[model samples]
Target: MTTHTDFRAFRIHNDAAGYRGGIETMNTAALSAGEVLVKVAYSSVNYKDALAGTGKGKILRQYPLNGGVDASGVVVASTDPKFKEGDPVLCTGSGLSETRDGGYGEYIRLPSTWTIPLPTGLSLRESMILGTAGFTAALALLRMQDNRQTPALGPIAVTGASGGVGMLAIDIFSRAGYAVHAISGKADHFDVLRNLGAVECIDRHQLVFSGKPMDSARFGGALDNVGGAMLAGLLPLIEPYGNVAICGNAGGIAFESTVMPFIIRGASLLGIASAGTARDLRDQVWQHLASDWKPAHLDRIATREVTLEQLPEVFGRMLAGDSFGRTVVRVGKV
Candidate 1:
């Protein structure tokens, strides 16, 4: 493999002015310390990446870092026993864009422990099509299943349904035989949501956001991405003993609600921190993403592809809530 000092990356830096990210030429030697050097073929944009790139949230623990949380590529070099040159692998939520440089570049040097060898059924591009967003969706669904959630319970509600996690959640749950009710503010994408397996697509305002703390349980379970009022509203409507996996807080972080949803209705609120998941569970989740939990419409979910130079506008669009589904970045030749 050719070792080039010249490569491009979308790097973020915080200075006296504030946080900013843009595409720039970089060298392989400038990558953060790790056990494997991957020639990143693809990376996907997630809400966290939007936050980090646009400085809308506290996603980056430090500044002057690359800013993508999901990447899939071929390893070019490795000092770890688990990986070798030419291995197709992927990494997500291993502190990328948080404590270390991430996958926004054509190359990423990652700890081998953070890498998962590409499962038999997925291609390098297919892996990034799923990316961290899809992985989080799968992880949330798996957690719900572990807590005894089943298709027989009732329809599953996915809030923020047009975004990456929500779209993939809708697809995976529907394929798993559950009726999926997608709730989104983007009315224009209702047909797209249905194409991805949403049995019903409800407008964000259609649901009652203000009412009694406890209501008749409407959904068997739910995957909540917009975590402020939307989540507060959904908690009281989950079936008894049903699970609601709390993933993203795209709406707002703080919310107020009574304990009746938990204590009276026997509802369960499960926190999903995809980045901090244990290695074993992470491995299990990725295995499922490569297999059964993989979305049937992976190509459809990856609705857009861009070069690294286009990331700033993409992140801006995400913060404005104008983007939908997944946007994969072609970082390098596969």
Candidate 2:
């Protein structure tokens, strides 16, 4: 094995100079401690990655770490018996770019517990395209279904419809036999959302919710990427026993609501903290993502492919709300 190969990483630092991120030469030996050392093939951009890359949000626990929350690669070395020197694997969340180095580098050392063997039915590139965004969506669905959410109730509403999670949700949920009502601020992109299997496209700007804690049910459930008022508003419109799996907060954090929906309607608000999901649940989510719950429109959803050098521009676009769908990073050979 290469003991100390020279590789490049999109490293972030915060110090006397200030918070910044850029490509830098690094060594495999210098990467954060892990049992598995992988030659990264691909990584994907999530809103969280953008936040970490630009220091726009408090994402990383420590500084001077490589920046990327999702990665797929071929293992080059491992101390763990479960992984070998030539296995394909993928990881999302589990502290990448948070307290440790992440997948923005050509190489990554992953904690064996968090690394998933590339499941049957997904290529490395496809896995990265699904990455963290699709993982969150699938996890939400799993939680929702476990709590009794079903397609028989009504259509599933996917907010932030053009974004990575939302677009994938439309595809996943619709494929799972539920009608999907997509809501997005970007009205012009409604056609694409529809093509991804959204039965109805509701413009976010035009959709209004009654302030009442309980209203006439419109959706069976929802996979909401927008929190704040969007969350508060949707609560009242959910069917009885419907689950709202919230995975993002792009629309501000705080929200005002009442217990009427919970008490009278039995509505559920499932917080999808995907970053630190447990091993068993993570395994379950990945298994589904690689099989039945996989998004059908992965190619359409992966809107851009870029190298490490182009991350800054991508981050800027994501932060400015100009980015839609997933942006895949070709870290090395795919």
Candidate 3:
């Protein structure tokens, strides 16, 4: 039996004046009521979590909430027969950082239905390394494949290529036999992108959309993390029957574009919202991520790991666009 009564958490509070967040020592009993109590081993920081923690965007629906969107750990207590003590598991999205207390803490209480057993090929650390970002990339690939994307079709492009999802997508797309074209604003990261399996690294500025409604085809498909003008420019360049998955709005949310790319070339614009994915599809995607879809450069993709106390600074860096790759938080031990 353990005698731990208090643990550290990164919590955010909103007030009449403004919002503030920091690491706080919290009582274990104060965790919100749920069917399962998890001793979080690791949690990865997402762009959404950065917004919630730093108040850059309206991510938290409530005040004084724990602020992490992804966690993996062992179950410490459970009221559901689907889980038991000592089971390794993880939960992503399912209203974390928006509707309830999330996984920025040493302990988390979550509905068992949101929990997933750690798949056979992934360890607790490995799962959090992939977290929501890698999962989103894999989900996008699955959707693209479902729409008939194949390795022989042509090169696949990944925008925001230095970030977590982009890095993982590059590796997975290359490993799956697709030629990956990585596009990013960070010139310094071009070599890093190539090391992660991108066959071509193009600067984001290299893409100058011709004013024409539809330009010549370039890529077979794309995983687009930066939205707005970049996305608008990309649409005109996709080959016929190509699909582009839109997952992030780090750039401006709105863009000006003609419908010629969609109507004339049969290109698809896929919207990927990872937070509300159905449980069955989530299970399927995670299983694939653990098995064949797992990237060969997971360790390379996980660039940094910080403790609970260091999360606030990390969030600041993320919001400033100064951070890259994936940063996992060490919340507790296995």
Candidate 4:
């Protein structure tokens, strides 16, 4: 590999008035001070990344910060005795792209605690394909399982089935022997969702309610990616003692609901915040995704690969809700 004093990155700048992000060249020394510096091979786009890249959300508190939440690559240098040069590693969440210069650049420097040895059986490219979204999905599934959710409890519902987390959740749940019901606004992608192991697909409109506080029980549990009414609608339908893993707030954050489900039915609503999870837990989830929980169709699920220069257009597509599955960003040939 060729080493250069400076490399390209997509950085976000914020001032007293505004925020903006675009491509720029940055020196390796410009990276945030950390114990390890990595030559990033691959990164993946997330909804948070799109929000940060376009200044749609206040995701980055620091100005002139490199922006990417997920990166997988080989270590180029390390002060931590546990890691050495050329070791493959991946980093996600743990305040990446928010408090530190993240993976959008060719090189990223981060504390050793933020890095995980790339799990065996997953290549750097495949690991980036799972990225933070897949990890969140896996964590959600594992949480539900720990809560005693099982395939014998009837069908499990997954909201936002067309997005990265939803798609992966569908694949994971289906493979785990549960009947999968995918909820999506994009009826056009019904076939694709089915191919990902959704036994059935429900249109988002079908879940909409007109002031009703409760609906007929339909699912044993749910993995909800879209919040708001979709989540509110889901609560009443969970079987007694069923679990709902709440992850994203893409649809909206607020929803009105009563406590009938939890109070009367004894249902559990589990919140999944992959970003701030303990490092050991994160490592365990990565191990699960690399082994027993690994999706069988990873290569088929990833929809596109683009270079760093192509990110702006991709970000625009994602913001418009026109993208699907995973979009891996190739920072350097790997």
Candidate 5:
């Protein structure tokens, strides 16, 4: 069957005219090279998507590309035998929206290496609701566990606890038997955080860190979405041999901290670069998410659902710091 057909995409472009993104008619033939062509059903917005959609951040390595990093849909056609017509699949990171056309379109061509079969427990829609945000959170937990960080060490502190990754992390970590201590500047949302399984909620604005490099151990580890001062402050409070997974740089990139946490206390700071994650590890994380690590509050975590026309408004709100939870984008009918 011929896969070439006209479809709409939230494509981004840059040239002499300057940076911009909006809905435009496109052809499946023009999509970036891949073995699997999917009729996209759902995608989700992340901080990176907002940045890429609005040109606020340099998320795209090349121009004239579709702009959603997370996508799930049914296969329309496939050159690879692993996928066939109407089989559900999903992909996150792995170069979508950066080096290639992404999920914001009604149809997307996905590399076989990155396409994942829809896990048994998740539907195509639920898979995108988790998206890249949830993937990063699960990857952090897996790495922390690999580094020998355990629940017996102490409670895990989740910074930026009101945002997508933070909220999902609370649900995932709690389901895996870790006591989650949520730290957020939005004190008004503490009760909501509790409902997502946070046992303790700390107001970050009122958090006072003694400038000292070493402090009393208050947490076994942390999954920090805010970096800069937040990362600097968290290190000193981890238990011995604890692991801190840094997934986001919402606060700032640079930070000043002493080596006491690493040298004296054996604290490990793990970097969570979800994009470009090796295929094996990516598969491992997805498997766990479909089973034991799946969040119990996925429906609640997906707080907003929008069509492609509403992406600009969603991007504005997210970049303005008004984003609460995950925003699922309904791309096209399956």
Candidate 6:
């Protein structure tokens, strides 16, 4: 139904100095060549987006790239048999915002193989609200469950509990009848974590290691978004045969950890990589998020909605570790 060729986007450019993102008018055809073109309705900000936008991390290996890892919208055209004109689709990761154009734009052309029909029971906005962060959170839980993690075991600890992935993990574990202990550096957001179903909250500083090889068992399992000392400290305290899903590295990437936990406690470390997930697993996770694993307080979890022009400010807030919950960008109306 839309005929516009040039649309607005938040594009990042790399030059002799560094990377920078700003609003610009871009041609639909200028997007990377692909089988399907989508009119983006919504996208969400993640830690990676902030890294790409501000050059805080080495995420974008290419220059002049559109930088949003998650997007959901109605399909405009498709040359592939799997998708047709006017079909609603969602795409996240799969090299988006990295090797190809991404979702910070009003329009994005992506390979048909990378697109999935928006799962039933979730709107375009809702899908983006969950975004890559929420998807990773759900995937972590799913992996833990597959490894025999159960609600009856003991409390599940979620690190970086105020961040996007951490908050959703708290909600999912709580809804699944597990007691969740949220660990956060932002002590002020303790009440928010509690409202999101975290039964107890702990400060990040309290999770530092004390050079001990092992500690008293505390958590049955853990969804850890913070790496480094937090992760190292948590390993020795997990119950036997427990799983720890390692996702983010908001804390420093390096940490010294001993093998005592794995050898003695039988704790397994599960790595969650949303970027290279298999299509079958990605589809299954999305379905689960739309059905049984969907967070009940999505509106509350989404604390802010900003236009493309307001993204720089949001990125600043995120990098300062001041933003909480999800921030969705309104690209267009579905």
lDDT for each candidate structure: 0.88, 0.92, 0.88, 0.88, 0.96, 0.89
| lDDT (Cα, tens digit) per residue for candidate 2, span 254-297 | 99999998999999999999999999999998889888888888
Candidate 3 root-mean-square deviation in Å:
1.6
Tens digit of per-residue lDDT, candidate 6, span 12-103: 99998666789999888789888898999999999899889988888987888898999999888888988988899999898888888889
TM-score for each predicted model, relative to the true structure: 0.96, 0.98, 0.96, 0.95, 0.99, 0.96
* Candidate 4, 157-236: lDDT as tens digits: 99999999998888878777889999999999999989989999999976566455556778999999989888888898
Q: Per-residue CA lDDT of candidate 3, range 228-275, in tens?
A: 888888889999889999998878899788889889988999999889
264-303 per-residue lDDT for model 5 (tens digits): 9999999999998999999999999999999999999999
> Which portions of model 3 miss their true places by more than 4 Å?
1-4, 16-18
Residue 190 in candidate 5 has what lDDT?
97
What is the C-alpha local distance difference test score of candidate 6? 0.89
Model 2: CA > 4 A from native: none
Prediction 6 TM-score vs. true: 0.96
lDDT of 1 by residue, 182-246 (tens): 99988999999999999999999766665678888899999999899888889888988889999
Lowest lDDT block of 10, candidate 4: 206-215
- The TM-score of candidate 1 is 0.96
Candidate 6: stretches off by over 4 Å? 1-4, 16-18, 207-210
> What C-alpha lDDT does candidate 2 achieve relative to the native structure?
0.92
Candidate that scores best on lDDT: 5
- All-Cα superposition RMSD per candidate: 1.6, 0.9, 1.6, 1.9, 0.7, 1.6
* Candidate number with the higher lDDT (2 or 3): 2
Better of 1 and 2 by lDDT: 2
